[model samples]
Target: MSHAFDLALCALILGAAVLAVTGRNVFGAIVFYVVYGVLLALAWLILGAVDVALAEAAIGAGVTGVLLIGAWQGLADAGGLEDEAPRPVFLRLAAVAGAGALGGLIALAVISLPGGDGLTLAVVDNQDRLELGNPVNAVLLGFRAYDTLLETLVLTAALAAVWSLTRTRVWGGVPGPGHVTRPDGVMASFGRLLPPAGLLVAVYLVWVGADAPGGAFQAGTVLAAVWILIVLSGLQDEPRLNSLPLRLMIIAGPAVFLGAGLAGAAAGAVMGYPDGHAKSVILVIEYALTLSIAATLALLIAGPARRAP
Candidate 1:
């Protein structure tokens, strides 16, 4: 049964991918892409990668779908949603050949790879040192802390790049378009009711991440989604990039992580936790990261500054 289910899912995923790529309308393509992400998340779950599933569902499906929808809406508003010139038949054929070749190469690579425990045993053996119940969390926040730190920095840098695209007159201004909502609308009601529940879920995910599949990235995505809903429903206005509190929230994660690394250096190695305090230090970093990541992702989806500060 499981094998049959897996085969069916693979078929669905392939169909969704094809539709996402070839759909005539941008909106339809975005919707199909979201379906592809959701199916991909399910595939990850079936492969016993719950952490990857969570990240896929949150970032790939949820956040990316919202971002694409926003972009499509913007294009529509600007009268840029009209169909573009079609590619020449030869160019289209070349693209198909290139895509097929790439797919074949990927399949070959996967087939040639040796399958083994591959880091699981090593991570389990060293998990005690990090005091994290979740081996994935231990690897992310402990053994591979530098990589995670770099990823956070990359997200911040991406936000900086987005801000750089702002007009000179609107530099350091508010991010995202102004939203006005009818007070009695479903969106307004959802904006009022959902955030409180979302906040609890976000906090719980971050707190439980030390021992489970949940983590900073998934929790941060949820938090960002809630904020986006609030802004979109007109429950709150987008914050100016120059706002002191907003700026602090955006940098809190990286700043704290860097500080922890420096403090770790004083203990003999960078990003090293002091003996008997690994969990405590990691939790602190996770909380800070959750805040920063949430803010950064929300702003990224919101796009560059528009209104004046």
Candidate 2:
């Protein structure tokens, strides 16, 4: 039964991917891409990686879908969404051939690989050192803290790149355009109703991350979605990019993380925590990361400044 279910799931995922790649309409492609992400998340769950499933669903499907739709809307507003000339037949054929070759290579690699819990046992044996109940969190926040810190910085850098595209006249202004809707509309009603629940879920995800399959990325994505919804429904406008408090929130995570890493010199490593305080330090970093990640993601989807302050 499980095998049959897996086959069906794989079919659905493949179908979605094909539609997303080949669909002519921009909106249709985005919808199929989101479906692909959700199906991929289910595949991760089937592999027993609940944390990965959550991250994939929240970030890959939810957040990315929003980002793509936002971009679509922007293009429409700017008159850039009109249908364009189709590619040449030769060019189309070359793209399909190249994609097929890459897919074949990946399949060969996966089939040739020998699997035996590559580092699972090693991580389990040393999990006690980090004092984290979640092995994935232990690896991310402890064993490979530097990589995680860099990941946060990458998001910040991406945001900076997006902001750099803003017109000079709109510098220091609000990201994205102003949004307004009827107060009694469905969107506005959802804006009012959903945020409280989203806030609770985001908090719960972060708090339980220490011992369970939840974490900063998932929680932050949810929070960002809530904020995006509020903005879209016209309940609130995006804050100006030049706001000091907003800038501080954006840097809070990386600043706190870097400070903690520097303090780790006392423990003989750059990101090490002092004796008996690993969990405390990790929690602090996670909370700070949650705040920065939420703010960064929300701003990212809001896009570059488009209005004067």
Candidate 3:
């Protein structure tokens, strides 16, 4: 029965992927893409990767869906979605061939992976030393802290790249399209009710991540969505790039993570915790990271600044 269920899910996922890629309308394609991400998240859950599933559902599907929809709207407003010349048939065929070959190579690599206890055994062996109940969290924030640090830096750099695309006149201006919603509208009312609940959930996710499936990234994504909702409903304005507090919030994650690493260095090893203080330090870093990640991701979806400071 489990094998049959898995087969059914795989079929659904593949079907969604096809619809996303081949849909005629851009809006339909984006919707289908979001559905595909949700299906992929379900696959992760079935594979017993709850953390991965949560991230995929929130960031990959939810946040990315908003970003793409916003981008599509922008392009439509700018008349950039007008019909364009079609690519040559030969070019299209060549592209498909290349993609197929790459996919085949990836499948081959997955099939070739060595069968054994693998990294799971190693993670379990050292999990007790880190004092983190969640091995995934331990690997991300403890064992492989440097890699995670670099990942945060990469997100910051991507935001910078998005900002660089702003027009010269709007450089360092307000981010996003600055949408305004009707005061009595459903969106505004929902926005008012949602943030408080969302904030509570985000905090809980970050706090519980120390021992559970939630984490900074998932919490951050939830917070970002709340901020986006508020801005879209016109309850608040998007912050200018030069806003001091906004800048601090955006950098808080990487800043705190780097600081923690340096603090660890004081104990003779970089990114290491002093004896008996591992959980405390990890919690602090996660909280700070949650704030920064939330800010950075919200701004990323908001796109480059459009209004002057």
Which of the numbered candidates is closest to the native, going by highest TM-score? Answer: 3
Clashing pairs in 3: none
Candidate 1: deviation at residue 245, Å? Answer: 1.6
Clashing pairs in 2: none
Report model 3's TM-score to 2 decimal places. Answer: 0.94
Better of 2 and 3 by lDDT: 2
Over 69-175, each residue of candidate 3 has an lDDT whose tens digit, in order, gives 98899889998778734567899789879989999999999888888856889999988887889999999999999999999999999898988898888777888
Q: Rank the candidate models, highest lDDT first.
A: 1, 2, 3
Model 1 steric clash pairs: none
Model 1 lDDT per residue over 1-309, tens place: 989999999999999999998887899999999999999999999998899999999999999998899889989999888755566889989999999999999999977777887778899999998889999999999999999999999999999998889999988899887999999999999999999999999999999999999989999999999999999899899998888999899999999999999999998999899989999999999999999999999999999999998
- Write one digit per residue (lDDT tens) for candidate 2, span 159-182: 999999999999999987688999
Give me the runs in candidate 1 sitting further than 4 Å from their true place: 93-115
Error of 1 at 134 (Å): 0.8
The C-alpha RMSD of each candidate to the native structure, in angstroms, is: 1.8, 1.9, 1.7
The lDDT of model 1 is 0.93
